[model samples]
Structure formats: C-alpha cells, structure tokens
Target: MPHTDVQMDTHDIALETPPADVFMAPSICKSDLLAGKSYSHFSPIPAHISDDMTTECVLGVDEAGRGPVLGPMVYALYYLPMELQQSLLADTHHFDDSKVLTPEVRSSLMRKLCTDGSDLHRASGWATRLLSARDISAHMLQPAQYNLNAQAMDATIDLIKEVLAKGVNVKEIYIDTIGRPEVYQKKLERIWPTIRITVAKKADSLYPVVSAASVCAKVTRDAALDVCYEPYQDTAVNEDKATEASTHVAWGSGYPSDARTSTWLKQNIDPVFGWGNECRFSWGTAKELLEGKTADVKVDWPVEDDANGDMRMTDFFAAKTEAGGDELVDWFGKRVTEEMEDF
Candidate 1:
C-alpha cells in the first residue's frame, strides 16, 4: 500500500475499553506452561474490511521477556494496512517504542486495540506466541540442542507463519533484531523471498508497526507475569500457603538485575528443587544455586530412555571388563546378580 499523508494531531481521538481481560486463566494455560511449551493467541478479527480495499499490508515483529529468569518470552506480530501505519499509529494512537510508555499507557493502548469499535481494533490484527519459562529452561539446559537464539528464531518464524495462515495480506515486514541486523535480515529474506523484509536494531522506535507489536508483546508478557501462579503442587494447601507459593509473591520485571527479582529468588528457592516452573533454572542465578549451594543433591542429566543407554560415568571407572568396552554390560550383570545400589 502507498504511504498516505494525513493532517492529524496526536491524541486527537481518545478511546477506552473495560478493564484488562488480557491474561488467560491459570487453569487454561498452566498445563502447557508446566509442560514447557509455547502457546499462541490471536486478537479478535476486526468486524469488517472494506470490500473495495485491496491495499497490501505491512507487518512488524518484536518480542518481550527474552532475558527474564521467570515467566514466558512472547513474540508478537502486528499487521495493518501499509498506508495507514504512520497516520494511525504516530498521529492518532500515540504509540512509540513500548519501553517508553508507562505500564498504564501500555495497558490503555492494548485495551483500545481490543475494543471493538476503536479504529485500531477495526484496522489491525495481532498475534503472540508465548514461550514458557519451563520450556525455555528445558531448551537451554539441553546438551547442544536448542539455545536461546535458536528458540527465538523459531518463535519469530512461527509467529509470522501463524499470522499469514490466518490470511492477513502481509507484504512488507519489519523486525527488531537481537543480533546482527544484516544476518537476521538475510535469514528472513531467504525464507520469504517474495515479501520485503527489514531487520534492524531498535526498529520498534523507527517503525510504528514495530512499536505497536512491541506494545502487544510487552503487555501480554506483563499480564502473564501478573497472573503467574505455581503450576505444580503436591497437594492442595491453605490459601495462605498457596498465596505464599505463587501469584502473591511479587517478582519485579523478572529480570535478574531487579532488586525485587533477586530478593524473590533468594527467598523462595527450594534447596533441592531450586524453584517452581516460574524459574528458568538454566539462568545464572538459579544455576548457581544448583551448582554451588546444592551440589550434594545427586542430579542426572540426559536421562536414560529408549534412545540412550543407562550408563553413568561412575560405572565405567568402577567396573572392569575383558576388553573394557563391555564393562557396562558386565557391571549391569553383576548388579543384577547382587544387590543393586542407588546413586
């Protein structure tokens, strides 16, 4: 779509909606979070699109919670008629880089976007993919499997694909990048050759669509943290203990540097388990606890399964075979013949 010039004052039209219903119920998504997975959410489709309108659309992508030691990392895509990007966002909606907006302002902007009759709601479509804390930890802790960068790339690609699958006419795409812009831009270009792509550092501040996407991703992440509760409990506990265990415990911004977050980590860490599903055990603070303070706990990595043989490193040193190659087999046989001992 051709960029349009419109004369309008920022904040000329104010909009309002009911209180935030942005977060899903803990019961609805807690299982997925506990299982260490990502879940997606699509904003309600606008009521109508003008039949005469055939403008190619533009999409922007950004993420939130990338560095958090708790909660989910959310990647969001925001798409709208290309021509209206500047006028609708900069001139009217007053969106900038979401980090610049106060929490109240971010919530307000999202509420307007969700409100049915508002121009933003009518003209825009957005989606978010929330990569849970448990899942992030699982990936990061894996031996040479997926790292945070790999997970982020997958999430970004998945979000864009999801938005396109919903049938939005996405043409030009803008992205805020965590790494080298040239590398990320080239990678995306190879995937969707026909679509124009721009990947840049701080693209959210440079492009309104990216800014809007940032707001969506940030607000959703914040709301998720706002409602986060312990996904697993051995038994039902009293409200006081339950509250002490979960949502009532405030973790400020989930950043390791935040004083509140560090304090929460120090206060709630289980000596053996470390923390609940809310924690990214692979992160330094939690990792240190397991490695430095609680090293006495016998922990196993790369658990034995149908694919991997059940051999611990200690077994090789403790047993001897004729050729040494068969020591594990002999060790197992001897263990079966005698009493087996736990590690």
Candidate 2:
C-alpha cells in the first residue's frame, strides 16, 4: 500500500499513522464516510531511506468496531523497521492492547503520533481502511456475495497493498484474529507467498506492533463514531428535533450489549429506513427491530430484474391445452404470447 499525506488542520482528528475523540459531535460528510478508502502516514518530514538499507520491517494488523451495530469497521496497520520495533513501540512508548487502554490514553497516544516533532511520529507509519456501515450492509444483504469473514480479509489485504505501494518493506506481519488462527494464517500465507504471517488469538497483547495497530484501529473507530451524524434530509424528523437528535446521541461503544446503543436504536429507528447509514441493517439487533418492532409492510420478494424466470397464467394452464386441442391451443397461445411480454 502506498501512503498519502492527509493534511488535518486540527489536533484531535486521527492522522494517516496520523489517523478520534470520546463523545465528539458527528460532522456531516466532511469526507466520504461510505465511499472509497482512507490511509495515514506517520514518519519524519523526510522519511529515512537508504540504498543499502537491509532491515526488514515488521507490520501488524488489527481491527475495531466489528461488533458494533453502528459505525464503520476500521482496519489499521502499524509498521516500522523490524530492528527498532520493540525498543520504540513497547519500551519507549508503552503501547499495549487497545481494549485494556482507556479512551483518553488511546486518543492521547494517537495525537502524539500525529504531532510532527514526536519520536513516535518519526519512527512509525500507519494507515486505516474505514469500511462504512452502508458498504457492510449492502455486501451482507446480497444473497450470493454475503460473508463477513471474507469481507474482513479483503479489507486487511487492501491495507497491506496500500502500505507496500507506499514503499514500506514489510517482511513479517502479525494479525489478531476472530476466526481459527491456523486457518487464517494459512489463508494469508497463501495470499502473500514471501512475507511471514502469523494470525493468532490475542496477538495484539503479545506483539507491540499488533498493539500499535490496535490503537490505530480502535482510536479511528471511536473518533469515526464520535463524529458520526446523518444529514437532515428525512422529512419525518423535524429540523429542530433533528438538530437536537444530532448532538451526542450517546451510542456507547457501538456494541449491541451497550444499553445506550440499544436504547438509541429503539428510540431513533426510522421505521422505513431503520436507522441512519451509521447502523448496519444486517446485524440481528437492527434487523430484528426493523422487522418485529416496526409496522408491517407487504413486500414482493424475488424481484424480477432479468429476462428469465417469468411465469404467466397462460403458462400455468398450458398442460390443459392438450385436452382442448387446436381450438384451446390457439386461444391460449395468443394470450400467452401477448401476456408473457408483460410478465
């Protein structure tokens, strides 16, 4: 993956290694939250490079917002030269698994990394794929192409590709996994024939690189949710009420178990659209509310989009044409030809 310089005017927003806040107000489409992808770079103004540089870099991959019913799922990658990985990341900075860290600490560390003068900024580089809720729902809802695991894998791959394109020499990769570690490891090994890959349970806690990636992923997700707000196009929600609704909806952690998230879903569901693009419709919590709680709507399934699979009343009674002979055949054939066109 190649890196791009995303210029941010403020200190709070996540940078690209540079990529959030707790309870921050959602900004309305400041950038495309749903379309395309974003990445960050964190290194000295003139990135250190040498023609004879032989040090292979270690990289880690981790994600946040997977369980959340709302907000984008974030995949982040943290990479630095392999030799300096532990000394700078673990001993110097004390980076650890993001789950155990408080929101304040994560935000603070990410902020420092974004700062130009910091040692962490000079030594490390990171990037993220902000997989939107709308994209996730649309993928899962599609009958033939639906699979969350595959979707996650693709996001990771895209991140790595972007990193390599940006001139990072990643020789070894570590990943924290939600699936069978051996299986995931084997899959990634097959994908990247040359790079050493390890997918493990709690890899984030064990490896500083993975832990760094976790912070990048976790903090980006939190900030994304913090600034998450839907545009006020909905006619049912009054502008005054909608403006009131926008300020801190208190969707705690975006997990289904969070009482605040559940309460927000119930109180804010649109009935017709369910929730804003922030909420994933494929998730059980969102789906159940839309189907069981909202008013019933009659739907015609198996929508006819293609030319095949069309049936008509004439086709149904075609077998009876044998009994009626030529007279019936002529009557039914005429009806079938004209009506089949409509079907």
Candidate 3:
C-alpha cells in the first residue's frame, strides 16, 4: 500500500485586493497623516468577523422603555447575514452602540438599517394592555416589579416568535443583559428553551448586530411617541399658561431622572386620568401625583366641525368656555359678578 500524506501550504496566500479607486479609502488628507495620524484614521473591523470565527446568521435583540414612567416596553429583533453585515461595517465605520450616538446620528442610522438589507421585527406591551396602574397600585412595589418583568418577558418571547415566523434562519441570539447576568440568562433560557441565547453585559457595544437592534428599537419607540404626542401638543401648550410651562421634551431616555417627563406626569394626574389608570402609577411620578405636589393642568379638546358648517356644542358649558382659563377663573376662583345660575 502506498503511503498517503497530506501537505499544508507554508507560503502566504495572496488575498485579492481591490484597485485603489475601487477600494474604500479613508477621507483623511495625506498631510494630516504626516503630521500625526489620529485614532479616526484607523479602519474599523467589520462586524461579520467575530473573533476570527465566521458566524452564521445571528439575531440581535434589545428592549426600550424599561425604566420609563409611562408607555409600553418595546422589544426589537434584527437579523443580518454575514456578507451584508460585513458590507455595512465596511461602508459605515461609525456604526456602534446606539447609546453612544447622538439623536440625529442614531436617527440617520435607523433609517439606513430599515432601508438597507436587514430584516427587522418589533413587539410591545402597552401600559393599557397590562394590568391597569390602579390594579398595580393596590399592591406593593415588589408585586408591581414582578408584573412588569413578566410583561417584558412576554413581549420578548412574542417578538422572537414573530421573527421566526418570517422564515429567517437565526442560529444564535444576543441580548443586552438587563438585571444580573446569571438571572437574566436563566430567565431567558426558561422563556426560550429551544434557542441558544447569550446575555452579554454590554452586547450592544460588543456586537454590531445588537447595536443595530438597539438603534431600531430606539427609533421605533421614538416614532410611536411622536404619533401619541401630535394631538397632545396643543393641550400641552394650553396647560402651560395655567401651570408651569412644560418644556414638552421628547422621550428623555424613559428614566425617572428626566425632569421634564416627571413634570409632565405631575401636571396630568387627576380624576379623568389619574396616576393609577392613565400613567405608569407604579413609578415615583405616580406617588408624586397622589401627593398633589405637581402642577395641575388639563388638556383642551379640539372643536369638531360638523356638516352644518358649525362647531358642535355638546352643552352650555362648551358654548361658554374658551381655550384660556376665562371660564374656570370666573367659576372656580372668583365669584360670578351677576347671578346667571338660572340659565
């Protein structure tokens, strides 16, 4: 029998390099490099290359509104093939965790990802759909925390199911760790027993896929807020006169530390839309609402244009009141000058 031996190539393989014009060249001037090349001149490594190992399609998962005093918990999933991922990495060297980018840059990247070759899926648990704030308020903070966590987990599972239904082949999933790493891993494992899941402390910073998902989730949630806020802008302005004028700021990271958001909550807590039912009464803002310390303001409803070329007046009160506090000031604060009670 002839001895068979396999030989490995010792010489370095010549990798194909594109022509100078065809290849992407850094925008730095030669003079700048000669003076002293800064870190910006360094080329970024493509996301598709994962620690010298090429990975199959990877699904990135992220959530938003985790600490918000209002609104629902939003979860998003992004899937990218190795080739397209590398292409995106090569084209846009600035791609990184969404938290590191400014709002304008994040918005731009979000639009690019949605239009570019990436599959996106999102799911949410609106405050209305979950147990009412009143119900949660009936219990202590611990129970409320449990309920919110349950809601978030349910939303995440639903999002994963939606992505799977779309026929995307995802072998591995990466999540930005929420609570304790071990706890999050166990919780995710319990929720998604079939899939291989990894809970990274800062997956968004480490994994390009997770960063892309974060951008998607943040942008989608922001857009939703804009939709919810359109009708309320006029109301916000009107309320500002009676009470402290609200800054009417955009969603400020959904954290309790956001002052404008806290002020908005303080202004809106009342009977028609009290802390427990209307807002996330479980938050500290809700406690403040119950204490009656924040500003008291009400949003104004728009006048309806009827077919008879007249505005609909449901009652005498509607006919008498204006956008300003004229009626309220007269009725509540100051006594009526004349006895018009009979009307």
Candidate 4:
C-alpha cells in the first residue's frame, strides 16, 4: 500500500464486521469501582528471531483512543530487525508519515500484517494492553488518584519489559509521547542504560516503526469500539441478513466533542445505573449528564458515621488466637496465671 495523505477523524470507521478478536476480555484489574476490566495480548516471537537470541532489533511504542470518552485506550509496541525497519515497512509497505491512510486502508494493512507466513507477520513481533473504560474511569476517580499519563507510561514499560524478558535483543527504542518528551526519554534511559532510546512528540510521523505501531493501536481500538456497541445495537438491526445495522457507526468517534457521541450517550443512558462499562464515568461529559438536570433522579450515597475510624482494638489481636471467650482476659489463652499451675 502506498502512503496516502491526511488522517481520518475516525468518526465513521466503516468496518462492515467489527474485529471482535482484538476486543479481548480475559484479564481484569482488581478494583471494586470497575464494572469491567482491562486485558492484554502479546504476539508470539517472529520466526525471523527464532534462530538468533541476540538478533539486533528496533522497537516502537504508541497508543490510540487516549482522548476518547468511550472505548478502551490501546497501547501497542511493534518491533523488527533494525536493518529491515526502513526497507520492509517504510519502503516496501509504505507504512510511513503519520499513518497517512484511510480507516479501510489501515484495516487492510493490519489484516495483511496478521496473516500467517506473510512478510510482515514473519518479521515483526508486537503486543497490546487494552485499558477498559471502566478500569480507567475507576482509577482516575479513586481517592488516591491514578491518572491517564501514569497508566499510559506503565503500559508502555510493561510491553518493553516483556519483550526484554523474552530475549528479543532490543537495541533501540522509539516512543511517541504526549507532554514533556525529554523527561520520559530520560526515565527510559535510566531504566535501560544499554539500549538507545528516543522519545518525541509526533514520533509516529517521524519514524516508520512508530507509524506501524500507530496503525496497530488505532485499528485495534476502532474494532474494539465497535464491539463495545454490540450490546446496544438492538434498535438498528433487522432479522434480514441483507439489512445493515445503522448503529454500526452511530456512536461516532467517541470524543466528548463529537455531536453524535453526545447524542448517543443521552439516548442510551440508564436512569439509575447510567451508561454501561464502555463509558468513562470520570470524564466531565459523562459525569455532567449523569448528575445534571437531564438525570431522572438525584442520587445520594449514604455516609458511614465513621468510615475511616471504624476499626476497633479487637482488629489488631483477632489474628493471634481463635479461643472461645466473651471477655478480653479469657481470650488470652485462658489466662497465664492458670497456665502457671502446670509449671
């Protein structure tokens, strides 16, 4: 595929059939606030690296759907032989310059990349961490506070660490970052002193590897968004196979600013529970709709009389013994003085 021009706004990613495989749901984040959880997938080592444990390679990292108020934020890492970085992806496949392809084109490229025995498939190894909306919203909304940036950074680092542990001779790393690139660059450098690392804004446009990673992330998130809509596709589908579901693209780009997304949120929200796990409740858009005048009933959570100070003295000593006793002295192993009679 030749490199095209301009990035589509992703408002109407017309995938006739949503790529359900990418919307993995096996793993989970441990949190009471989350209605759903996140998951990950790591591609098997490429055949090209099977024979050589120390094969020199270059890796790139990028993410998609970070700003969307709906769907998961997918962080992806793609790597291949350092020498083939330019020749194979850039020159042969034209995966260059800011992923200058349409949604269909990107999807097509990804399909080819995933095909067994394909040139790209045999040469490259990749992975993704799909952060579910419920998990993300719950984290950000938690009392301690874990924001998106920290979550993004951890996902990136986890991918790299897994690659290293798998013995993929990573020689250099390139990352597409938002906000202070130099700080991220230095942090990575400190962690992996041996590998050369570059962290920059728009690294996707500057580096072919990052561009390919961008494609992987964007395609996965788009397909996942469609999957997220499956539960709510009732109104648009017909019994006839010939009829297409109008709701396929109804959710729009999922950004808070998108008119279609705003309308969809208004139409689908539950009066009591709000939207499904696909929504990020922490976002101002979702929060406002759930608590604003549009809401059917005002919700007031009951407060405990002493939420933070409910712990009693018994809590500290409960684990020490399991004796039957109503008094504190009887709890202490039938009293030491009675035990002294045995001595």
Query: For every candidate structure, what is the RMSD over all alpha carbons to the true structure, in angstroms?
Result: 12.1, 10.3, 22.9, 8.5
TM-score of each: 0.73, 0.73, 0.54, 0.78
Tens-place lDDT per residue, model 3, 1-343, is 1111112121200001111121112222333222221111111222333233334567677765455554433466666664555445424545567666655666666554434233221111111012222333333355334555555556566666665554445567787866676777787788668778888878888776777777665554444333333334554345555754433434333344555455665565564466423245556555555544443544568998766565555544544556554564466654465446645
Model 3's lDDT to the true fold? 0.48
Better of 3 and 4 by TM-score: 4
Residues 1-343, model 4: lDDT tens digits = 1111112344333322234343332112324113356878788889898678778999999998887778888898999999999999999998853245666667777887788989998999888888999888888888888988899999999989998999999999999998799999998999999999999999998888999898888877777777677667766556677576444557777776666788999988888888888888888778788888878878999986886396787765553435554455675576877889988
Q: List the residue pairs that clash in candidate 3.
A: none
Candidate 2, run of 10 with poorest lDDT = 1-10
Best by lDDT: 4
Q: After superposition, how far is residue 182 of candidate 2 from its true place, in Å?
A: 1.4
Q: After superposition, how far is residue 104 of candidate 4 from its true place, in Å?
A: 0.8
What would you estimate as the lDDT of candidate 4? Answer: 0.78
lDDT per residue for candidate 2 within 191-271, as digits (tens), equals 888999999999999999999999888877777765564342233546665643234436655666666667888877775
The Cα RMSD in angstroms, rounded to one decimal, for candidate 4 relative to the true structure is 8.5
